[model samples]
Target: MVLQILFIAIALAGVALFSYNLKKVIRNIRIGKAANRTDQPQKRMMTMVKVALGQTKMFFRPIPAFLHLIVYAGFVIINIEVLEIMIDGIFGTHRVFGGMGALYNFLIASFEILALGVWLGCAIFLIRRNIIKLKRFSGVEMKGWPKSDANYILITEILLMTAFLVMNAADAKLQAMGAAHYTTVGSFPVSQFLMNLLPNTEGALIAIERGCWWFHIVGIFGFLNYLPYSKHFHIMFAFPNTYFSNLEPKGEFSNMQSVTNEVKAMLDPSFTPPEAEAGKFGAKDVNDLTWVNLMNAYTCTECGRCTSVCPANITGKLLSPRKIMMDTRDRLEEVGKNIDKTGNGFDDGKSLIDSYISREEIWACTSCNACTQACPINIDPLAIITELRRYAVMEESQAPASINAMLGNIENNGAPWKYSPADRLNWAKES
Candidate 1:
């Protein structure tokens, strides 16, 4: 009963802390302008299923994708055993679902296998990051906390899986010994090998089993709380992020409704424009971007897959789509902290543009959708980049000379080129 109470308290506290952090993330995301991602419910569901759940886009790099899928599948499937653990912890019962008989055995067996797979996958991933030094994992944005965060998650997962297997092995030994309260329920196909390492004494085996059990559950709670602060938050956010994915063609850019209304009014004098809204022409900060844009920032995996495929980055340009998302997220976090310190409408003289993201970086983008297509969960770093560019051009009149000349030509000649409509036909004459 004492242990049960302790478990309940620990679980409740863990859940409460996680909820608090999750609320902060949601509030930060809501700081951005409203976007209509709620539309196309059916299509969104399909996208979530195909991309986030199925991990269809990850297969672009088969080896890493396969390893990642193993870890991903293991994470989802092994959590079923956590349910049983929770039940046992709360009720002070042994193997609470053992009554399910063959079904329970099958579940435990599968979980054991998956746990091993997760361990192996995470181990390989660690090697790939630290030893092999994969290019995608070594971007400028991935330095410091981002790099440490990835390592922390992988190591923690490895430890948790190890504890799980050890716990099972000890439990199996206990069952064989006909120990009290240690039911002969689970099938330890993978953990069975670990049984040889455990002590032959019953008391020592129980101690090891109980210790591992506590460690595993506590580690899970710790991992859950750690996620919001880590890039691995993608694990949870991927589903919703993919669901709210921009369904438009990759090359298509979103137009500001305010600008659209103004254009319509100018083109058709009879067209009544809505009441003028007081806001910046384009995104100057996190608040100026759409909620989906902010969500995309928080959802970035920092895998650098976007950066790897970027033509701009490939050609030695300052623009890294991955860095754009990272900067947005960093800026959003800074803004969130400022708001927490002051009130809701606080400003610290720092904005995403020219603060976290540089003008050179913004202008370096070729406007290609390579990054968007390369993302496994469909995170659109390009969307954030374009918003910053819009802010620079419209609000600050800070576009590059080439872009300024092109825009001037379009405004004056009704085309991107300086040639008049009549003169356009002269090119055909010359041909």
Candidate 2:
């Protein structure tokens, strides 16, 4: 009765959490608009298959990637065992892959080996994140996050996997002590070896087996409940996030619409345009951004891949690509409530250029597209930076003086270098 209730509760919780997240994802997809690009259907489908199904991005870093693959594959394959356990717990009988019983045993053995691989992989990841402290692996430096979150998650995953192995081991021992189960004979070796060491007592071995089963089930369910709130939330979100990632021209900026001009034109066409408003354009709040931009903020795994590849960051500029995502997410969270209450989400008077992202940071971008290229989830930081640049130069006239001089030269001299137009043909003739 206890087992039945526990199984039902866990099953319900899993379904509820998955359903809520799935609904949010669907809502985002319906609302999120990507600019129509050529051959989009093929591109989108291929990207979905390659990145989402193939686990391509995780492979960019070999050790972590390999470990992740093991864990991912194990999680998928071992789910059969989980279902069997649930059914047995409820019905008091094993109802699983009955035909090709030998193959089923082989599958179980494979997952057992894979479980150990996952534990080892997670251990290596923990060491790299905490002790080794590589700059590339340093995710967003949240101010108040407990230092123990990563450690705790890693330890829990390892313990859970170990419990699974121990459960099998305990079962193998029971089988050797005169149990006639086919799964016990061929599905586990470590447990079988350990069982030989135990006394031939059915009651004692059965008790041990039951304890391990409970431990394994409890650990797995506990981890599942904790997943959404943790950094490991990416484990579930990443696949969908990758599938729905924005694929657009990385070099271009989104067109910004000006409200001041529209308002003034509506009020009085004869009134002269405001000088201060001439060049003011950029996103001042979440609603001002495109839905895709908003989705980008939520999809960020805080993996620091963008930060690592940022030329601005490498050259000692104040901008961290990771921080751009973090800041956007933070501000969205802050202003979202206000937007919800009042339905006023636009920039009343604040300029995003001066207020949120500084001029120095905006100008520091080289437009090298390295950040975009390095991103695993197709986040185009270069494009975001360029959009801000467009707002600064065209809308606000707040660009560096050098840019104005260059533009002037382009206008009057027909060259950005301030060279005479007559000299353009001279170089060609000489060459």
CA lDDT of each candidate? 0.91, 0.65
Provide backbone clash counts, one per model: 0, 4
Q: How far off is residue 408 in model 2, in Å?
A: 5.2
Q: Candidate 2 regions off by >4 Å?
A: 21-39, 57-60, 89-95, 98-100, 139-149, 178-186, 190-222, 225-227, 244-249, 252-281, 335-359, 391-397, 404-431
The segments of candidate 1 whose C-alpha lies over 4 angstroms from its true place after superposition are: 344-346
lDDT of 1 by residue, 225-337 (tens): 99889898999999999999999999888878899999999999999999978898778888998899989988998988899999999988888999999998898888888
Candidate 2 accuracy as TM-score: 0.76
Model 2 agreement with the true structure over 117-188: per-residue lDDT tens digits: 878888887888788987775543543552466677778878878777777776776665557452443477
The ten-residue window of minimal lDDT in model 2 covers 28-37
Shift in Å, residue 240, candidate 1: 0.7
Model 2: residue 191 alpha-carbon error in angstroms: 4.4
User: Any idea what lDDT model 1 has?
Assistant: 0.91
lDDT of prediction 2: 0.65
